[model samples]
Target: MARGDGLVAARHLVHYGYKPSVYYPKQGKNELYERLKTQLTNLNVPFVPDFTEALKSADLLVDAIFGFSFQKPLREPFPSIISQMEETRLPVLSVDAPSSWDIQEGPPKEGPGAKFMPGALISLTAPKPCVKWYRGQHFVGGRFLTRSIADKYNIDVPDYPGVDQFIEVGVDADEKL
Candidate 1:
């Protein structure tokens, strides 16, 4: 998704004792895919193919198909995958930003027919403007920001008293950044 965030998250899942099935876009063979495959192998997980396995097998889904750097107009397979996920009504945790979501503009506009509620959106580093209308749980991750860096980016982050890596923001909370 966003750089190596998805792969990194999958690795974390392994550390947390969850068996994660990673389904990349293409069949696993290339150099990058091989690297990911090796990592997954080391973690004792499966690096599998997508489409059905992703929707039918997993208890929950992680929307890491795209992140903050994703541009407009999703290509083939991704849109279908997202539509299938939505139809399945599975609980999804969007990593950084939801797939098909415009990084700066949020979810795509329904052309006069639908109103869908996307599930939880987790923003790393800082909250993106795309999260404005998200009603579900909003979590802020990437707990490495110093006050000076936060201020430099005009991000008003709260003081993390200890070793907290994640801070959940309420749906109605004012994130002054």
Candidate 2:
């Protein structure tokens, strides 16, 4: 999983009164990642070693496994992990685009990625090109984007009501989830 996203998600979950456990097979050496992991530990979030065991009790899975930079031929461990996710059919909320999806191409036409579909997705900053294939609850986050940046990029920033951090797209404001 993406360590930074996982950290923020865990923090939010804790804030919203959910006890979340993380299963990270390989720890990062960077100080930022170290600090993030430490913060999770400080919050009493368990770092599980076994994905299979974690799956048995997990109510939902936040798939921060990969992001926009990922271009794959189904590399080690992830293929198996993603396969397991597919097999379970549990509700998965992918960060950014779903892991292994080509940003421009959307979901792969074949392979393990093709077999998996997350129940929801939260696009950071803005929605990527791949979102066209995402037939699930989609949310736009990173509300800190400046108006100047939006104009420079010709991005249509959604008019979020009040102090909401995220706004659901492709859905009516009254139908917020």
Candidate 3:
């Protein structure tokens, strides 16, 4: 997996004494991935050998494999891994969007790759329209925003109670977002 969200989740899990297993099929060419690897080592996150190891090590999955902006079909072992995850019937907490999903179209039900159900989805900034199809818990993260920023982008800002950051958006959304 790439550094970004994966690294952040790994650090938090380790800090909380949870043995988070990271799945990196190959060494990343980016500087950020290298930095993340070092930080994760310092944090003592277990870099599992492969997808099976990571899946076996986890009770549930925190899917930080790909962010929402990704548009290409997943390559190689990724498709196999996604299949395993689907067959295993594990609860997946997808960050941003489910890995390899079309940014606007959501999961590809019938295609070369990607057709799994995530148990929960944590959408940052703003949720895409496809998030509506998610039957499980849908959480809207990221608090502390300016009204102008939300208005400019037309992102519906949810109200928080006493500094709470995340909101579990249920059915019957206020039509603000």
Q: Would you estimate the TM-scores of all the predictions?
A: 0.83, 0.90, 0.87
Question: Tens digit of lDDT per residue, candidate 1, span 47-130?
Answer: 666667656778777777767767756677667776775666778788776766676666778621023345787788877777
Q: Of the candidates numbered 1 and 3, which has the greater TM-score value?
A: 3
**Highest-TM-score candidate:** 2
lDDT of 3 by residue, 33-145 (tens): 88888999888777887787667657888877776756576778777776776676667888877776776676787754356767888887667666755668888888856
Ten contiguous residues with the weakest lDDT in model 2: 168-177
How far off is residue 158 in model 2, in Å? 0.9
Model 2 accuracy (lDDT, Cα): 0.80
Model 3, stretches more than 4 Å misplaced?
A: 112-114, 171-174
Top-down TM-score ranking: 2, 3, 1
Question: Can you tell me which runs of candidate 1 are displaced by over 4 Å?
Answer: 1-3, 26-37, 111-116, 172-174
lDDT of each: 0.69, 0.80, 0.73
lDDT of 2 by residue, 1-177 (tens): 445787779878988999998877667697987898888888898888889889989999998877676776878777878788778767898898888788788777887788778888988888888887888898988786799998898777888889888888962323323
CA RMSD per model (angstroms): 3.3, 3.4, 2.3
Local lDDT at 84 for model 3: 78
